[model samples]
Target: MKILVTGGAGFIGSAVVRHIIKNTQDEVVNVDKLTYAGNLESLVEVSDNVRYAFEHADICDKEAMERIFAEHKPDAVMHLAAESHVDRSITGPAAFIETNIVGTYVLLEAARAYWSGLNEAEKSSFRFHHISTDEVYGDLPHPDEHPASAELPLFTEKTAYAPSSPYSASKASSDHLVRAWLRTYGFPTIVTNCSNNYGPFHFPEKLIPLVILNALDGKALPIYGKGDQIRDWLYVEDHARALYTVMTKGKPGETYNIG
Candidate 1:
């Protein structure tokens, strides 16, 4: 299969690209804007592979995205490009809104156009996999907040959308757009909302890497509000595998909560 992965230079996106290039026979075309968080250095291991290709392009650019679709003729798309930092989103929401919401909208259109041009068999197998976060479900009840005897549940596939931060809200909006395209246009789209990911080559702005890097340097670890916010953590490699499994084997027009 020929797959196009947006934001393939970032943490999780790079993981996905590496998994595809190393473990599978599929070819990957990575489309990334190369933002501060999106570093090409993350994909150094797989960069030399014949199955892997990188494009320094933003998903928000409609013309460039269209050209990419025509040029690569990808069989599937894994949409992951966005401004993902919650603190950054709180300070500057415009980037999150533009990149997450508007960018996803544009990518969906571009992918749909490409999918429409395929043959019946290719169209049936083509997929638009929108990768999103579990933060879109808002804050789950932590065990510390309640008694240890009380049931602390995980975010399920049916969890209601209650995004608190701008970043999560933008992701929620993109998820909706992806679903809308599937429902209205018969596009073969699948949405996956996963837990927090932490692993190698992670950007320094995020909590896990920041904590580890700061602790090593004897710098203060900035905990948000007494270090009580709990999140379901998944290793980046684990997430990439789960995403690939779902994309290749998932049912059309169905939402799978991959964590």
Candidate 2:
């Protein structure tokens, strides 16, 4: 299968690309905007693979997305592009709205149009997987907020949408857009909301990497609100594998919550 992965140069996206290239026979078309958080160097391992291809483009560009669909005719799409930093989103939310919401809308429309033109077999096999965050489900009660004996819950697949920051809200909005497309237009879509991810190649702005880098430089490790917030952590490579499993084996119009 030929898969087109947006934000494939980003940390988790790059992990997905490497996994697909190294472990499977499928081909990959990496579409990334080269944002500060996205680095092509992460994909150096598979850069020379015949099955790997790269396209420098933003998901917000409808024309570019259309061209990519026409050119690659991919069997699956892994949409991972977004403005993901909550701190950054708090400072400037316009980018999050444009990339997370508008970009998802544009990508969905482009994918729908492309899928409409495919033959029955191609249409049946095509998949659109939207990768999202568990943050869409607002902050869980920390130990400080609740008694220790109380249930420290997890964000299940059926968790209600209650986003806190602009970043999470934009992602939640995009998740709705993808589901709406699936229900209304019959677009084959799958959504996954995973917990925090940590591993190599992570951008320095996020928590784990921020701590690692700052500690190396003897800089203060900034913890948001006393660092008592709990998060279910998943390794990037593991999350990539889970995403691949969903994209290939998941049911259409069925949302699978991956962790």
Candidate 3:
């Protein structure tokens, strides 16, 4: 299959691209805007592969999305483009809203149009896999906030939306748009909410990479709010594999949680 992956130059997206190019017989069209967090160097390993193709375009550009769909005729789409940093979102939310919410809507419309033109067999085999974050479920109870004997809850597929930050709120909005497309238009869509991811090629802006870089430079590490907040960290490679599984085997109109 030829899959188009948005944000394919970003950490997790690059991992997914490399996974497909190196491990599968599938072809990949990497559509990324090359934002500060997106480093094409992360994809160096697979960039030279015949199965890998790259397009530098913003997801919010409807014309660009339409052109891409028409040119690539992708069998599946792994949507991952977005403004993802909480700190950045707190200071400037417009980019988050524009990229995460509006961008998703544009991509969905483009995919719907392309699918509408496909043959019945091709349409039935196509998938639009929406990648999301666990933050949309809002903050979980920290150990400091509850007794040791008390049961702690994990974010599940059925978790209710309660986003606390602008970034999460934008992602939550996109998630809603994806489901609405499925229910209202019979779009072949799947959503997956994943926990924190840490591994190779992670941008230095993120916590794990920042801490490692700072420690290497003999600088002090910064922690948020006494360092008591908890997170479930999933390796980037594992997250990539899980996404591929969902893209290929998951049921449309279904949601999966990966950690």
lDDT, residue 99, model 2: 96
Q: What is the C-alpha lDDT profile of model 3 across 1-259, one tens digit per residue? A: 9999999999899999999999999999999999898999998999999999999999999999999999999999999988989999999999999999999999999999999999999999999999999999998887777888878878888989999999999999999999999999999999999999999998888999999999999999999988877789999999999999999999999999999
lDDT of 1 by residue, 151-199 (tens): 7787888889999999999999999999999899999999999888989
- 15, model 1: CA deviation in Å? 0.6
Model 3's TM-score against the true structure: 0.98
- The TM-scores of all predictions, comma-separated, are 0.97, 0.96, 0.98
Error of 1 at 37 (Å): 0.9
Q: Which of the two, 1 or 3, has more lDDT?
A: 3
Please tell me which predicted candidate would have the highest lDDT against the true structure: 3
Which portions of model 2 show Cα errors greater than 4 Å? 144-150
Q: Is candidate 1 or candidate 3 better by TM-score?
A: 3
What lDDT is obtained when candidate 2 is compared to the true structure? 0.91
- Candidate 1 has a TM-score of 0.97
Candidate number achieving the greatest TM-score relative to the actual structure: 3
Candidate 2 weakest lDDT stretch, 10 residues: 250-259
Give one digit per residue, the lDDT tens place, for model 2 in 39-126.
9999999999999999999998999999999999999999998888899999999999999999999999999999999999889888
